[model samples]
Target: MTEHRHTNSSTGGTSPQLSQHKHEPSHRYSTGKECNASGSVTTPPRPSGIHQILCIPTGKIYIGSAVDLRARWGTHRWSLRRGTHHNFHLQHAWDKHGETNFEFSVLELVGTSDLLRTEQAWIDRTGCAARESGFNISNVAGSPGGIHAQEWKGFINPGGNEATIINLQKFCREHGLDFPSMHRLAMGKSKLKSYKGWTHRNSVRQREYIKTYDGFITPGGRPAGSITNLAAFCREHELDKTHMVAVAHGRICSHRGWTYATGKRKLAPRTYTGFINPGGQRMLITNLQAFCREHGLDIVHIHEIKSGQRKSHKGWTWREG
Candidate 1:
């Protein structure tokens, strides 16, 4: 018998030259139907401009905002690989279909350097799918509005960083409607957490502090009640109290929950704070005068003091006296 042995490459001088190129399947199978089916329906790249339609498969129309049209699509492609797609609506559609089923097209690109403002306009116009987390989509930062139809349609002229009050003067002037009473506006909206009007914010501890702190000194240096026991106190004092105002720090009472509803304990007096007023950098003396005119009340009392040290003081000193 003749013995024959084959030498391996590791032993030395190549036994047989190994192919460096990748070995593919010798017989190619034609899944040409799959490619053709996907190809027949795949949408083409979209151009930039106003009023473009993106034929994103059935139940997947995502109207979006973008600075550059092509760049946005490129980002979507990368997002697919990284699997960090932020838009859940779009992702679900993509998962169900694939790249062929989706297309991104441009909608009116308002030429402005301000990308955020541009996006905000689109969001407001189209009502983006992921609006809650999307850029420039608005929600209540503080306070509330949109209870009435008129208020809902009209733009709220935010007065300060904290939107505690609506600018009724602007709303009236813009809409050509008679300036509504502050009380009406206050009554229109539900008490919100942003204003400390919610039951959760009106903790017993907060009421106790309001009741006892510096003896309920009003912001105007007059003695006021801690809404907890003000009315009974007034009734017992027999001072002929008519109306009262509780001026809280912009930060404190600005909590949406801290409303007249929450502030008015059964024993507490009716109280008005800056939150109840149309807020802005400047307080509307005209509005305040109007409120006083509308309501038959003499004394507008305040009930917050700003001293590091708490001291007892006589209540209800007349400003003129």
Candidate 2:
């Protein structure tokens, strides 16, 4: 077997360093190995098989199968520790019990070609999919998992009601809309467009938290006019809604001789740390005002990211200092 180890210094000595092992080549199978959190070696059988993560206190097991059991276990541990695992139930249990209370084990070694079939048989025999039993979400082994895939569409629209259904391809074809774009929106992978009422039967309208703006004011603090919706105001004035909101919140004091007045008080500004590329130069600014003054960067764009309206500002990233 050939072995390779990876040391992660950023973990502060808490996380276990990972070691990967590859077995000598076999005509019918291959094996991978790793070390678990307990500093114990994991059994990686030739090719595929059933695996389990057992919670000692609860006696709850998460049954799974993988082509490479050791690699899968490592992936699970990494995701669970990072709080980004897809299985919320397993993640919750991990959080409650910590690594010490959990055990990773291989149940049976199966041929690579029989992986899915054997896995399905094991799942059926164990009743892993039953609620209050195991952590397996679906009884069907080797099925495509996650919320964004087409397999989940049936789960999302279980009723299959034709009345409420919106055929994405047909609708997009008729309307001359981009099929891929509309498909993504229908699949809940992208934001819904306001221009069309195009929505799938399972589509859930996201509740938007709209902020009320009173009106725009002049430089002398005189009332310009009342505008209820920021988007409407932007359209009427040909101003960017993002920029206007930044101005309204006092991120930028004024835009084009117009000041904003809001009935709701703005949030307290936060300090941010900025880093420049190429040389990794760092700067600390107390607020958007200080950042604008120091860097002479676009005030509106900086405000967008600082206020969480935009993710990135001119290819630069900022975090709370």
Candidate 3:
């Protein structure tokens, strides 16, 4: 007895057509052309998921989740090649290493609903931002999935009603203040009292928390002098006061060859040294390095002459210190 079997009309044979399984949940393929037995073309699955740009030489990867991987990769490549990419470090690396040295890879398949969470998880698992090796500038992801919103309280205006609070970033944007500076103020890390009339609720406590730095050292590791007010010192030295404060607070280590330290040193009064010119005019200098810096002369060369290692420099003879 012969048995009759049903044939798929699309295939024109007693065989199942591949397109018949297109809607199947288990069917998955990348975006490309799929030829059917009927001479018709079926579109492959569009990849929408996590992607990465890996620097083959450095092994540093920039992970990103996109709805359309091809389109995103094109945009990224365009921006990187044009040197207009938002990620400064990534752009710099791309510029340093040519495009051929980098490899674009699809890391994983993800759905729209799971995009942010999956991306954040991948970033965390890779420790991309946690370490300085990667180009990621921010430790937190773009999506709110991993944010501890409950732990972060908005800054309240102390001058206004108790309930009157504002977003720190918004306030900074509106007033031309820096968000990180204001955030540090709110977190009790900055000694700033206020920013354009917006004061952090913790400003008072922060003011008390920060230890006062009253002394400064020159770039050459010599004691400059005691300075009660950094702003005044900066004004006198024509230096950036805010940068000096940051250095003093240890927020930054050094700036423009100057460093900040606490406690005053009781050193002997700086005796003025004289430089004898060819015409016999004596130039009195309280700080030799400072004078050399002001006159744009090399201090080491001057020191060598001062120590009797050399005869003279720039037609000037170093006298007694």
Candidate 4:
């Protein structure tokens, strides 16, 4: 039997492959006549802007944002297929339960900065199915407040407490964002407890853990034992606990995690700045040739030299290698 997955974005279908470039076309797909089939159209490039979510079968979900939903789902498709996202827990769940037990759905589309705000509000409010869909229900009610922006007194905030998947798609459409696809596993999470597993605290712990590993030393002098330990660390360090929660659990951590972990280059890959010749001297011909060879470029060629050009070709090189 063919396995199928669905996304809660604009395209309500199962994904086939993970494609990078956030805007590149995926090469593989299924030919079944499924509306959001495993394979149909070429992977649409993810657009720039907005928040998103992914619903899973186990009743557990992932809340996130993207400049491009298409690209994000594509990459996830690859990871899930490759068994990369399958950690010990997930693997065990799959073995005991099944892949069809979990499903992913998008909940909302907010400004990148607003993700934390909405997430915080959701965590604070802790009502409705907002976490499952990522939709800020205030937008549906015509609230004037921005996603995470502070609402002016008496102004109706667009992000309300009634977030849902359908509303999330509407929000994306209103904002011209590419909708994502839902991904479901055959099984459910081992445990399911609202406000217990995968809470804001867990999110914060994930971020703080990464930051700590990346050399961010909290004032506590070392990594704390757990979330409460983090609270203790923050207290000892005199950090603002509220803001710290936002920083630790917000979308910035997830986005930065992607930036730091994936992709070939750190930020901008290729760069070209004029060489810094040491000792205020011209480079030797052999040295230049060696440099070019190391860089896998063609050999040196005499293009042309202007008259009175004081170019040196000898004893003008220094190497620290």
Candidate 5:
């Protein structure tokens, strides 16, 4: 996989072996297809440029542009035979289809500088990168997206009744989320409901009782027992989860028997600019979303006023702290 942008090596067994003679440059030897007058196979300089390996039976294809097509093919075959191909999709297909079912052929010949661009054009024209359509492991032309690289699928934050939909990778980096774990969760590969009280925006597995939720409580609202997952607790007690969150958030005074005993992050305080209310009242607001909800204000208008894009929103005006 050359997704990181490097010359691609071949997968054929006829890889270039170290030259036995000191004067001759390293030459790639085919499997003895050509022979000297002695009637033996011959070695040939590797061909270069855009080439493709096709699974004849399945019609799957992998495209690349590189020098030393033979050497690149050798590397491909070496990795595939060892079950270590960086492009897992191609490897998987190869495992299912017999090795003899594949063939390598050259496409358009291009200079080294144009290899990536030309290859990308071919990939786009062929639609080889479409999922399940071809063997390509990356949409990027020269990028094979080695096994370690992951495709990002955005996620949602489904806390309370509100939800936040955003790029999962960027969100994880900004919010200090565990990328691997959250990735699994977002991809629907993990059974975990929530991580540290944060929820996926559109996870089908999301439930009223979450793993990161605070725990069970006694009906008296006094000290209660704790649990690792609310779902597990609900299952064990045959309890309804509909009102559990309400009780947890104090929206409902109490539910069957549960209270929120949750851990909280201690963070440095934020200095919010004091804004002059239309009624001539100065209010120090920290959470804009919450304030807008409380006063039935449009957040966008408030942002415009604060940024000086507009003079004011309705009656709200921006003022410095």
Candidate 6:
């Protein structure tokens, strides 16, 4: 498993070191519980932090950080195992060297706001982006201390006019809004899709492109009416739009006996297919991240809920389907 390799300095010089914290990821496979170099169980760091993936054979380390380290690590292992890791170099290395030669470890524990800047410092120190050195694709950090600095950004308001602005920095300055924060959301870097009712539009894709969509609801076996606004309908009659949308899209069984009237919803391919029990009520979750964001639930606990390790999250029972 884990090798307790220490370095002379923070910037690794000769061989890649992984014994930064008191532990090293020596588990032959990621089992939700992280094991130390000495084979003792060490819980994965909490809140947020930086992590490193080290290829011992080539001394190439992939530096990354996440809001949830365990979940992020699980994702990395999952992707790498599936041979679909975004980092081709890392995947190639794993395919060449074998999984046993690669070890993952904690670089530095950081808060959510400090992730990017701290990671940048590590990236600069390690030079992980060097072609022959590491597996980092880009040397540029996504954020600086969780605050972004970019110009000529674009944004679209989800609630208001769905019009796109060419330059968000200038627009925010003229309107006296936070540009850095908006820029993060607009660049699709942050988890939150909207900030202050504004959705960040990517330059490559118009994600804000909205076509007129409506749904019908049947309350107590009676047609309520053609609901033009799904969200407002959910709020007015004590329903979750996420569920209602799933019903309209024909993704789930039903959200309180509601279905699509036009019957084109099934054509919408993206659907919430995961099942979750929120507040002891079973509902279909089309997007796990979206559901977690809406309910303010931590992803780590959600994993536990599905695995039966956790009974409830924030007093709401969750079940796997």
Best by TM-score: 2
lDDT of 1 by residue, 212-266 (tens): 2223443354554444433344445442222322413222231222223223432
Q: What is the lDDT of residue 142 in candidate 4?
A: 24
Ranking according to lDDT, highest score first:
6, 5, 3, 2, 4, 1
Model 4 gets an lDDT of 0.33
The CA lDDT of each predicted structure is 0.32, 0.56, 0.57, 0.33, 0.59, 0.62
How far out, in Å, is residue 311 in model 1? 99
Native RMSD of candidate 5 (Å) = 19.7
Question: Candidate 6, overall lDDT?
Answer: 0.62
Instruction: List, residue by residue over 1-321, the lDDT tens digit for candidate 2.
Output: 111222222311222211121121111111244444455664444345566666667766676767776678678778777766656577788898787666665555665776676667767766766767777766788753322223323212112222332443344445555555445655666565322323353345432433556677865779866565566556656777777777877777667667777533446887666543224456655676776677667788776776778777666655564
Query: Which ten residues in a row are the worst by lDDT in model 5?
Result: 13-22
Task: Tell me the spans in candidate 2 whose CA falls farther than 4 Å from its real position.
Answer: 1-46, 145-246, 249-251, 254-321
For candidate 5, lDDT tens digit of each residue in 80-183? 88776656677777788857666555555556666677677777777778766677867787653533244444443433334443444445556655555675
TM-score of each: 0.24, 0.43, 0.33, 0.25, 0.38, 0.38
RMSD of each: 26.0, 18.6, 15.4, 20.5, 19.7, 19.5
The per-residue C-alpha lDDT of model 4 at residue 74 equals 55
Candidate 5 regions off by >4 Å?
A: 1-47, 146-186, 190-321
Counted clashes in each candidate structure:
23, 0, 0, 47, 21, 3
Off by over 4 Å in 4: 1-57, 86-98, 122-321
| Distance from true location, Cα of 221 in model 6, Å | 40
Q: What tens digits encode model 6's per-residue C-alpha lDDT throughout 92-159?
A: 88888877777766666666777777777778888888878888877876532112223443555544
Instruction: Using lDDT, give the best candidate's number.
Output: 6
